[model samples]
Target: MMGPTHALSAGVAFLAVATPMSHYVHHLTPATAAVGTVVAAGAGILPDFDHRQATPARAFGPLSAALAWTIGKLAGGHRHGTHSIIGTGVFVALAAAATLNPWALAATLWLCMGLAVRALWKHPPNRPNGKLDYRDVAGLIHAAIAAYIAYQLVHSGLDMGVVPWAVAVGYLVHLIGDSMTEMGVNWLWPHPRRYRIASIDTGKTVEKRVVVPALYVGLAATVYLTYPKWGPVLLHTLQPTTG
Candidate 1:
């Protein structure tokens, strides 16, 4: 799937999961949910950093290039190494260690890895070269990461209760959205054979037809959901403030 589609799908997932999770956690503050959504969307994008030549690496200049080069050199280029399950696990561990919030870190890492694996196996066209798809392994790693994150979110010191669920839901949304595309996600990879829902040719059109509308609708819904009563609040906070 293209970057835009991935991003839109990720955003939709973020909102879909965050809203309900927030309510469940009793932290239904608009601000917390919104922040969670944004974070989830960003997590969706993190896996694509494997594409060294992509705009993101280019945009960051030497720093991005260096990072991409290192990843490529260490992992064997996009979709081959870093796009694998093992790679995702490594990343998740690193992220968790860095953040010192093992649960949140794990969740974000798992979500990204799962998405990556699904993308890799389902959309063979994305891979171009035929190779053993390790997406299933990646998905497992993602699951582990997500589980850890969930545990942390529930037990962590943060007063907020909804962030972890929102993040996980957002990630799930990303996976489901990818499945709708022509290059459907590898719902099952590293099995006897590869399975996919859409063909590469149709994937682009599917993205245009499905993801675009969904993004617009999601944005509208988010705005409506977050709208203030009595009067609109200017300069909305990323997270809702406690009175």
Candidate 2:
């Protein structure tokens, strides 16, 4: 799926779950909801940064690849290392330390970790080119991480409002959207080994078709869910707001 598509799906998923959650918790102010939603969306994209070696990253410049390579090297190269549970935990720890928000950090970390484990366990050594399917593994790891983050945001006590629910929804949508593509996600990765769904490859025509519409629809949903009248008005009035 395209970057926009992925982002939209994740964003939409976050909003969907976050919104309802906000209502349920009733403790999360509008600002908290917004922050949580944004964090969830960001987490969704965190894993794909591994594509720096591919053409997608080339558009930016060699620096993009270099950065990705450096990060990959640190984590465990392509898929086996940083893209794993251990790596996700490290990232969560770092995020927590940096932000000083244990709940948010933990949530994001959990999202990525879950997905990575699932992906790693599901697609067992079916490399097409005899080389490690680094890209595949990386994608799955990231997806799992993204899903976990979304889940955390929705359930976190920060907000029991609609925003949290929206975040969760958007994240799930993102995962499912990715699954629809030829690069199917190992939704049941660890348990259901060698499982895959029939779909278009990433960056393919069919994949684009599915992704584009999904993006627009998700964005629309986010708008509706975040609307002041329909959703929560957290963005505007929260004490000790984040900059």
Candidate 3:
């Protein structure tokens, strides 16, 4: 699946789980829920960081490119170690650890938000005259904004409890997305066998027509179903406070 599709699927998955979980998990405030959703969307492309050519790798220019190179080597190339069940656990653990410290959490959020913007935002295509692409500049602007938001969240003392589960679900959704592709993923790495439940070509007709639409519908349905709970909170957040 494409980066945008992976991200959309992960965001949808987070809401799907969070909607029901909210009923039982009383601490899931609107702020935390919003953060979790964004985090999940970002983490959806986390596995793709193992590929230098992936969207997340191109997100932050040389810095992300260098990280991707190191990760690709450590992960034994794309769709190998990072696409496995083991990789999910590792990422979740890292997220949990990041939540333990405000600075670390802020950094994590910044990275995730940057990744989310790069995947979700539709920047202009490259110029036909071989001029500079506004896409790269747009990414930098988004990165700056993401940094500010991350800092604000950390400063607000927002609950960090939801980070781990968001990361886990988002990462798993990514793996699941790839598993449905024609190439499939190595669910259990080092086993030398790829597993897939369906074969949909990435960015092709099946994904474009079926899977993408289903994800959008699912996102809308889950939002509608849970509006009764989070809707007021969102409205309240948006409302101006009396001095």
Query: Using lDDT as the measure, which candidate wins?
Result: 3
lDDT of 3 by residue, 1-243 (tens): 788899989998898788666677636887788888989999999999998878887776556767889989989999998999888888888889998888888888888877887887646431232234665566566667888988998888777788887888899999998888888899888786999989867565766788778888888888898888889988998899999
Q: Note the Cα lDDT for every prediction shown.
A: 0.49, 0.48, 0.82
Q: Please, what are the lDDT tens digits per residue for candidate 1 over residues 1-243?
A: 665555556656656555455556455555455445555554555555666654323323344445667877776555444443454456545544534565555454344433433332333222222342453244345456545654555454444434345444444454454455454444333222223455444356876788567776886776666555212434554347879
Off by over 4 Å in 2: 23-27, 54-65, 79-87, 101-203, 225-243
Which structure among the candidates has the greatest TM-score?
A: 3
Backbone clashes in each candidate structure, one number apiece?
A: 8, 48, 0
Show model 3 residue runs off by greater than 4 Å: 23-26, 124-138, 241-243
Off by over 4 Å in 1: 23-28, 84-88, 101-195, 200-210, 225-243
Order of candidate numbers by TM-score, starting with the best: 3, 1, 2
lDDT, candidate 3, equals 0.82
State candidate 3's TM-score.
Answer: 0.88
